[model samples]
Target: MFTHFEPALMKFLRDLQNNNNRDWFNDHKQQYEDNVRTPALAFIEQMDQWIRLISPHYEASPKKVGGSLMRVYRDVRFSKDKSPYKTNVGIQFRHEVGKDVHAPGFYVHIAPDEIFLAVGTWHPDRDSLAAIRDHIVIKPGPYLDAVEHQPFTEFYEMAGNKLTRPPKGYDKEHQLIEEIKRKDFIAICPLNENDLYQPDFCKMVASRFGRAQPLQKFICEALGLRF
Candidate 1:
């Protein structure tokens, strides 16, 4: 059953941030499961049901590993930092059709001083990016209307990396040129620490996501899929 996240969850994450080495995590593995993974799984299970009501396209994987619960271990192979573990908890509700992160998805991030909900396509493949851009050029009104909707605008702001100049084949003077330049199309809503501590946090998150459904559906439709 879903209740409230224990204060120790935050404490454990904070401690992990300071002592990111594997040795420290190895010693605290059980605590990690009890405080972090367990509750996170419960949250995902509950969110799974809630999100289905919004749209059957999204999924919340409940597996203890290789599922919606992102691995605490960081892939430091390519990066210079080489930290052994991630400081935050990441939960993604990906579209059923998406093979990986390249496709449209909804994300939840939890960490010390950083908690938010996001939805959109992040780092889409070349073809997918081109398709999204073309959709923006052809039917900008729906995209604009979705983001500008009062329910969505009340919480999220349009966020993503963008090209400094307009992309080729698109006019700089186009009304939606700003959106066409975006590489990652996303909307984020900040969540306070107290928000996570609430017993009704799951419901609150679901309601917020429902409010953002128009935006989610907009992206899905742009990609020629259903939400």
Candidate 2:
């Protein structure tokens, strides 16, 4: 029984962008829970069921802490701009064995100007990266077909940084060299703010992810895992 996202969710995010401090967040914690957090958790709960229907190998945790809901707190210890909170809501449905963003996963990013639905591995460890590149080298047809599929290509384009030169062991002139040289294998479909206002937004998003299943499955197989 999911409903449209509360309009206040966007308002809260806008406010957070302006006032990215703990004091401001503490003052508006209730709004965060009622307008943003609670609805987001409900969406995640429903998404968990929807995702399982597509593939039992993937999971969406509804927990407030370590679940799919990314923490609002920004890790500014290493960064120069020390904004205390993120101004967007991020939800990820990832492989059960995946520990972080590195694992093959699907993502929903909700923001004022940069909303999108994405899938793929981001910054994988050395071993995982090698596995993916090796797989692309051996059998690139499926990967090519998946990314170039009209339905998928209509919405998403290949994303993330790529190496200028071919990686070690990969041919510089290989047909799939560009894809194999990618540091992250991700695709994103930009979204409109109005899209979140639909009552069937959850199902709509799930369908988009479904269309990308071939790519997800391929990435999983390359990593020696189920999709």
Candidate 3:
């Protein structure tokens, strides 16, 4: 019974971008709840069912706090631009074993003029990075198939930071040396606003995730995690 998100979600975020202060957000909190949070939670709830079928190890939580829907509040403690709230809506259906954003997961970013779906680990720990590189060396075909073949290739493009030179152990002449130089194992697909307006939005997401399963499974195998 899941449907499309209303246009208000983007409208609210755009407005928030202009008036990013706490007072402005507080005044419009009800609108946020009604148009953004509520719809987002509903989407997550439906995705909870869809993700189980896609991968039992993953979760699409609908909790008000500490769930798939990321917090609206921004942690500006370390940065100079102390904006109290984030202008974008982020939803991550992370692996059950993952404790933080660095874990392997499907990420959805919704914002005005910037919308995309991403998958895999972002900024993984040193050990995890090494393991992924090792896997790429040992099993290059699957990696190639996942990226070069249909379904996955049709949707996503390899993204994330890359090392200018090959890593310590990997040889520069190696076929996948470029891939091995990656600091992140992330892939992303750009999405349009009309896509979100479709009634079968959840189904479309599930389909895309299924297409990316081979890549996810390979990463999980490398990390000794179930996909």
Candidate 4:
């Protein structure tokens, strides 16, 4: 039974932002477990049931490591900012066949600055990108139905990078050219902290996810995968 994220989660993350070093994190490790990791794992565990209602193909694994919950450690190998810890909680419900974040998924981002729920693919590979574009061109009606529908547009706004010009082999004059020009197909819904603190948070998330289904289904079809 999932309820709400403890308020302390945000406070811990804000504190981490100011002190993003290994020593500080090690000292505050118990706080991280209580306010962040444990609740996150519980959320993921409970969310699996709701997610299955959306699509059995998606998973919300509750494993402490290598599961839906993203790591708190920062990958600073190539980054200029060498801060060793992340300041946000990231949870992703990805498709069974999906390999990475690029796969069509539902993403939850929790941070002190902002909270948002995102759906669709981010930075898809060359072949997947081409396939989605081709599918959109071949079946514009369903694509439009997915994105332009009241349920989808009322909650989510289209996001992600777009090509400056028409993508190669796609006609600039085409009706769905703008959508086809996208390098990433993602939609985001901004959220308030209060929303996460609500006791019915899981229900709210599932409802919004239902609104995103048309787009998710289309993406799955484009990729020749089950939704």
Give the best candidate by lDDT: 4
**How well is each residue in 1-227 modelled by candidate 4, as lDDT tens digits?**
77889899999999999998999999999999999999999999989999999999999999998889999988899999999998999999999998778889999999999899999999999999999999999999999999999999999999999999998898999999999999999999999999989998988998898899999999999999998
Pick by TM-score: which candidate is best? 4
Q: Which ten residues in a row have the lowest lDDT in candidate 2?
A: 1-10
Per-residue lDDT for 11 in model 2? 98
Ranking by lDDT: 4, 3, 2, 1
The model with the greater lDDT, 1 or 4, is 4
lDDT of 2: 0.90
Q: Is candidate 1 or candidate 2 better by lDDT?
A: 2
lDDT accuracy of residue 205 in candidate 2:
90
In candidate 2, what are the lDDT values of residues 58-127, reduced to their tens digit?
Answer: 9999899988989988889999998989999999999999887677889999987799999988888889
- Model 2 / residue 35 / CA error / Å: 0.8
TM-scores of all candidate predictions against the true structure: 0.97, 0.98, 0.98, 0.98
lDDT of 1 by residue, 1-227 (tens): 88668889999999999999989999999999999999999999989888899899899988987778888889988999999999998999889897776668888899987999988888887788888888878888888888898989999988878999998888899999998899888889999888989989988998888888887887888788987
Model 1 worst lDDT run, 10 consecutive residues:
98-107
Assess each prediction's global lDDT (C-alpha) against the native.
0.88, 0.90, 0.92, 0.94
Can you write out model 3's per-residue Cα lDDT over 67-117, one digit (the tens) per residue? 999999999989999999998999999999998899999999999979999
